[model samples]
Target: MHDAPGLVAILAYDGLCTFEFGIAIEIFALPRPEFDFAWYRHSIVAVDRGPLRATGGFMVSADAGYEALTEARTIVIPGWRSRDELPPHALLDALRQAHERGARLLSICSGVFVLAAAGLLDGKRATTHWRYCDELARRFPAILVDPAVLYVDSGQVITSAGSAAGIDACLHLVERDFGAHVSNTVARRLVMAPLRAGGQAQFIAAPVAQVPRHDLAAVLEWARERLGETLTVPQMAAKALMSERTFLRRFKDATGMTPKAWLQHERMARARSLLETSALDTEQVAQRCGFASAESFRVAFRKAVGLAPSFYRERFGARQR
Candidate 1:
């Protein structure tokens, strides 16, 4: 482990998303006896410990109160029920104290609203779910909200776009604290993809396709099976039976990426899987993933993931006997 495991406290408020809370619990609280490394000590601290109703009518109880914030090395706000409603004054004060003591703060989805209400996000680059980006900006004009990326890490504060993005942000935290290898191991055990290529734009909804338009979904599936092949846009267009122009437009509307960009992402994703699950040399892995050489794969992988291929493998690859 790079650093000793820290105390992690998740704020449980009324009307929390149980899924988001579970994401934090699963990543930080779950046992990982395989690594023989220290793990975070977690707690569910309520603003008030009464019976609280989570999202979808699930009931939960917290073991501690807002005071728990004072001792936590990292504080996570899963989500807030209403953006317009202000967080409790006592809770805000505790958060402020936590910040003063240098605790790392994070928010998932609409939880950004709570941090904004506490005046913690003013003049800082932050993000929330795309659906709430405009309002989050309108309500807090001082904050810089980028709706494109999956998450933003601004030193002490971090925020994620939506539900599953919370996993991305949390995994990133593990990477920051321990190393990529530990984070990758945790991701594998949880059965989650090690990383998602591209930005939230890929997942954002777009205008409906014209009725006469050829479906690009089938072409995308076909391309996945041929990632190791030298596939091109014209080839994909042919599979969809459309001219390049119509194929490109429809592909973007459907998947929020150009055909070429999507193919690169697919290839890089396959590369990561090989690095994590196989012992093949980088050159062999590059060939299996359709890259011309290890050098070319390294450039593309770094551009896509912000890390070198060998570094990624070192973190996520199966341990040697």
Candidate 2:
């Protein structure tokens, strides 16, 4: 088991998103008797004065204030009250100091706005909910806003897309701190998938929430099954029985990514799975993922995952642990 990760401070304020706030509590604060080792120690820190109002017509009282952030190893910012509402100056200052002292800051949903307002996300790649991505970009031009991703893990600052994507980012942190085994166990308790790659698309064109386009679902499924093969836009378009131009537009509308980008994400996702679960060598994994060569795979994997395949395997592989 890994050493205990230090205190986690979850901020509470007026107009709180109860769901997002609850996510932090569930992942970090909940007692985990399943593990013999110590889990995260958490505290709710108040961003405003007494009797803060939250969503669903309830009030919350925090255990501490901004000062609690100082000793925290990690801080979670739940969905902000509004995109336009700037965070309190004191709260912003506290966050900046916490970050300067090397505390990891995790922002969920609209909470990215708070980080952006605090200038913590300057010159860094970040993502927020798709609806706010454009506004986030417009408001903070220095921040590289990725609308396609479920989350952006920029080392100290991790930002997640809307709502449930916060669960993915939190589980990812647990994996980083402990290991895949521990994270997967936690996921089982939560009844959720063990992990979702942060690079996975967020489906910006949410016609019916998460429902896929009927015309493209079959083609997408076929393409996913054939990730090891050389698939092209035209091939996908042909499979979908649409003209190239129409296919391209429809694909983006359905998936919020170009065919090539989607393919890369799928390949990388498969590569990550193989690295975590398989005994295959790097070259074999690369071949399975349709990379021309192991070297090409190494370059691409490092670029996309921020880690080499071997190192990733060593750190996350079930057998290695």
Candidate 3:
């Protein structure tokens, strides 16, 4: 067998996330004899000694300690047990040293807490599971928190949203290192989409958890009805009888997104449904979604949906009407 280029060390701790841990192992550790290219070698190292409890009701013991992290080219931190509990000093130091020596750090879901504790995410754009996005932002004010994306790759440090997004991040790393074809092969073996066509926003039912106050809810309802028309911040404010400044502030509070971002989100939702249900072509879909131009619609749709309109329609359309 051809030797792989680098070793991937996964940091396993007590109360580990079985799903995220499994994703990391499946992507990097699984044997792929079908491909001639050497894959990453895998090592599961304990952040501390003894047995680690996985979230999926199992116990696992690691053969190595945190020191293994120092020698790894890539280190994976699966979901952390709690954001409240600080990572061990040795673990944090090893992460810092590894990062300084040019090792790539990846965190799945709440495992970002460890990176945050190590100061690796300071001033870097990061993402975590949507459930913890607010808390991550609140705790680490310096880190730019983007809760909407499936993952954020800030060069050396990469983070993924909850659960399956970890697979996306791992596959992304594979694509970045070995190229698209290799990643796609691995994805096929795993029976997953070669490239998922969406972000965390599609999965989030309530983008904003807090119940909007009466006025804000009314404003949201009004905007919801007008997604096919050009919506301005001032117009949303006027509907709620508020000034522009207040509207912007309250919009963020009510939706966990700025008015512009929320409007794009809403429009995409409408466009996505139309693409799924209507026989209208791309240009018609864009027009009905209130996009200024088909080009702009394509850009926004690709960004929000993680795939082109044609692809989404092909994948999701229900005998287009």
Best by lDDT: 2
- Model 3 / residue 180 / CA error / Å: 0.3
TM-score, candidate 1, is 0.77
lDDT of 3 by residue, 1-321 (tens): 223549899988889888898999899988888866677887999876677888878997786787777678999998888889999998888899999999999999999999999999999999999999999999999999998888999889999999889999998888666544466678889999765544686577745637444467777778878887898887888888888887777666555578887777778767876876678998988988889899999999898667898877765555421
Worst 10 residues of 3 by lDDT: 312-321
State the lDDT at 220 in candidate 3: 75
**Candidate 2 wrong stretches, greater than 4 Å:** 1-4, 31-38, 82-86, 130-149, 178-213
Candidate with better TM-score, 1 vs 2: 2
lDDT of 3: 0.82
- What TM-score would you give candidate 3 relative to the actual structure? 0.65
Point to the candidate with the largest TM-score: 2
**lDDT of candidate 2 over 120-225, digit per residue (tens):** 9999999988888899999899999998788889999999999898999999899778766677788999999675533435454435636354477799889889
Give one digit per residue, the lDDT tens place, for model 1 in 214-296: 76668778988888789988898888898888888778766666777878878877787788778898898888888898899
Between prediction 2 and prediction 3, the one with superior lDDT is 2
lDDT of 2: 0.87
